[model samples]
Target: MGFKKHLSSLKSYEAGKPIELVIRDYGIRQKDIIKLASNENPLGTSKKVIKAIKKEAKNSYRYPDDSMFELKKSLAKKYKVDSKNIIIGQGSDQIIELLVQATCGSEDKILTSSLTFAMYEIYASHNQAKVLKTKDGVHNADQFIEIYQKSKPNLVFLCIPNNPLGDCLDRSEVYRILDSISSDTIVALDCAYGEFAAYKDKNKEIKPKEIIKKYKNCIYLGTFSKLYGLGGLRIGYGIADSNFIEMLSKLRAPFNITNLSLKAAIIALEDSTFLKNSLKNNFKEMKVYEDFAKSKNIDFIESYTNFITFMLPKSIDSSSLCEYLLKQGVIIRDLKSYGINAIRITIGLREQNKTTIKLIDKYLKR
Candidate 1:
């Protein structure tokens, strides 16, 4: 049997190790593990979300509302956009896939930074398309525009407050690309880390709805997995012009979101006090990471979101550090596959944050 050639070369996404998996591998007790790897809410799921999940679990046998009307309505009200402007997916990942499928085909090129999300490349290449990766970890407007004009990619994927690295693009850079790009070139803006961003650095953050409105061709992708602590629930959404939403929704799998997830996300959104406290905790903890890294003389990005990326020294191997941390029952993301010699650590709970700092300090000394 013949398979698509792209299937042979595509690299799969490596997620942060789960607590159970790490415990089994390291012979550590469940209570002893510190998981500051996935940028999940250190607070865990909200109590209101848990209550809603329990109530909605009984309806799991039934499919979610095919239209996802209520969820979209709630999101629309919060974001102050019409429901028609939004699209729901299993996660921002699924939306990425659909965007690639909807716009790209054989030989069509996609543009993104070299060290950004892997899924953009995975999905684009799976469709037998090309990816134009920029040279730097940070997005440079002039360089990207030069490439965009030359590559004239069918799609562009930009991760705001980029993953693993936690760096963001300048608004001028964003506008430069958006304004210069062809109307037909669809730009998919992954705002997965946007919620934490606005609180820390409002100037660098992109306002999804406003940007989408300004650049009618841009699509804004968001996820409840990180800030909402619903990774297990897999709820995410996209916002664009009505026509763009309609086009992408056509490619979305029917009833893509689950009943329990829908309810949990809705309740989670309403729990403003939980959201406020979580943001406050994250703000405080990011400083802990910064101060700790500074004391160690470690090169680390002052992250805009819930994580920090420490550049692995030339003398140190990233994989080795990761293995040592894992065995010590602490987990953080390694960035080897993206060709970066670095490790990304999520700003976990206060205790978890302290534990991770201790582990890294020991690793450095050893």
Candidate 2:
């Protein structure tokens, strides 16, 4: 009646509180609550995606395309990569799990920053691979290269515009790490927030396809969750070398992605107007939050993504501050989970952003 020791040792991912949970805990009405905790799109899914989902709703009785042919083909055309190089998943989360299963073993190790995305450590531990925590929070390329030269891991998970901190390693730093790592090591780049990152940067844009083509071991992971606003559909994909794609494809469960999700993702990609609007709204809100933080004399990390992380005064505990915010019907993330004395607030709709800032100002004054 016992599970593996590693299973017992694994820490579960702590997701944000649901709106219902916040309402129940604070005895507040659901209508008053605004959740900015999970880094999800506040605008929700695009109209085209919603239409596609509804149109395909009647086909629920039929099995989905296991190969995700059309989705893969669309992605291939969009990224100018070969269809053979693409592998779709329930989400980029599942793709991360699949990559661990496909490439790692009990004796293998997975390298990643200490406070990066929690999934990297979770999946690595689930696969019984040694989770090698890196020293830097930013995943500096020189630090990674120094460690890889010594430990030589089987897989590496790098999150650009790193979660919680919202700090991105420069492209030059990334290139350095790529050049230093062993050719045998598989590098997985989690670009879940890549679209938002690109939208935030005024001077630089990262073309993931270029890196994918240049390095055989490199794999780029993208999700419809952020910019396209398809978190509910749970659709994502990986772009890599054909051999890696084929290997990962074999391990992918049949009909792992729903027909509705695939249809929605196809339309989401084509909705250029929605994409542009989402970026515009996010950028505008980001500046508003930055100015508000400055006026309040609060220190915050500059972000190249939709979410902003800021520190509470030393006199206030983040957990208590989050609790207070919850009672006020604003649910922002408590960075205690990420081992920081900070909180992350996602860029929401203008009204929501304004309300959240007012609430924070009120809380700080009291």
Single out the weakest 10-residue window by summed lDDT for candidate 2.
199-208
TM-score of each predicted structure versus truth: 0.97, 0.96
For model 1, the local distance difference test gives 0.86
The candidate 1 region of ten consecutive residues with least summed lDDT is: 200-209
List of clashing residue pairs for candidate 1 = none
User: Which lDDT values do the candidates have, in the order given?
Assistant: 0.86, 0.86
51-157 per-residue lDDT for model 1 (tens digits): 88888888878977988889999999988899999998888999999999999889699999888888888888789888898888876777788899887999998
> How would you encode candidate 2's per-residue C-alpha lDDT over 1-366 as one tens digit per residue?
587777887899988888989767788898888999988888888887777888899999999988788999999999998999999988899999999998888999988988788988888888888988778776677778878889999999889878877888766777778888877889998888888777766342556578777888989999998888988889999999888788888888888999999999999999999999989998888999999889888888888887998877787688988888888999999988887788989999999998998888787779
Model 2, residue 39: what's the lDDT?
Answer: 85
Model 2's alpha-carbon lDDT is 0.86
| Backbone-clash count (model 2) | 0
